[model samples]
Target: MVYVKRALPPRKDNGQRGRVFIRRAPLNRKLRPKQLLSRFTVLWVNTAGVPFSTAGFTCRASSTGGTLLATANFDNFGTAIFNTIPTPTARTLVIRTFDADDNLFRTRTVRSGISAFAIIG
Candidate 1:
């Protein structure tokens, strides 16, 4: 089970506002099970009880181990993506960026954890 909690800013005057984005989480280890992350589903939540648009944005993830994952250029909104891959072994996952310029941006390490499936269910 994966969950992301974020606090978005209030709406602005130019009809622009913040957004809550979600994508597949990436696996960190190299020896882990090979799972290719290709699709992402996104939803926008309003904390200030205001409506917003979900256009003009992109969010995605890839499981190439060392391959770079990039997101579209976001002006004012916040984007969040998640990945779920079997961790057969410990590995390092890199989260790259193409937001402004094509370059490597972020990286995270993932390791095997105790199964809490029963607790969540």
Candidate 2:
């Protein structure tokens, strides 16, 4: 398994100020067999001081390449209080993938050029 942190420009949208972008791809046919890749599952978290909203997050995956894009929400709450006052900060993008056996196959964290914003916002 491998992890990579890309140097992307900071996001311009206020809702995505601390958004972290990640692209996951199979290393090779031998290292990451197609059978195992198909059974993989992804999970993420915010390691920075800010907390993700209860509204949840969104992820987009490619059917052919076995690649995925996961985004964390900074302020995704639906309540009135949280809607008006949002917490935007330098958040960390922690991505983890597990195999069929539930064994952790890969883990990575990106701290730069990230923001905490809601997927809907």
Q: Say which candidate scores most in lDDT.
A: 1
Q: Report the C-alpha lDDT of model 2 over 1-121, residue by residue, as the tens digit.
A: 7989889997677676678889866676355322322122222335543333434333322223244434323224321121221233223434443433445534454343333222121
TM-score of each: 0.24, 0.21
Task: For model 2, give the 10-residue run with minimal summed lDDT.
Answer: 78-87
lDDT of 1: 0.36
RMSD of each: 20.2, 22.5
Error of 1 at 119 (Å): 26
Per-residue alpha-carbon lDDT of model 1 for 9-111, expressed as tens digits?
9765764457656875668735556444332222233666332333343333344455544443322433344334332323333333333344443333333
RMSD score of candidate 2 (Å):
22.5
Full-model lDDT, candidate 2: 0.35
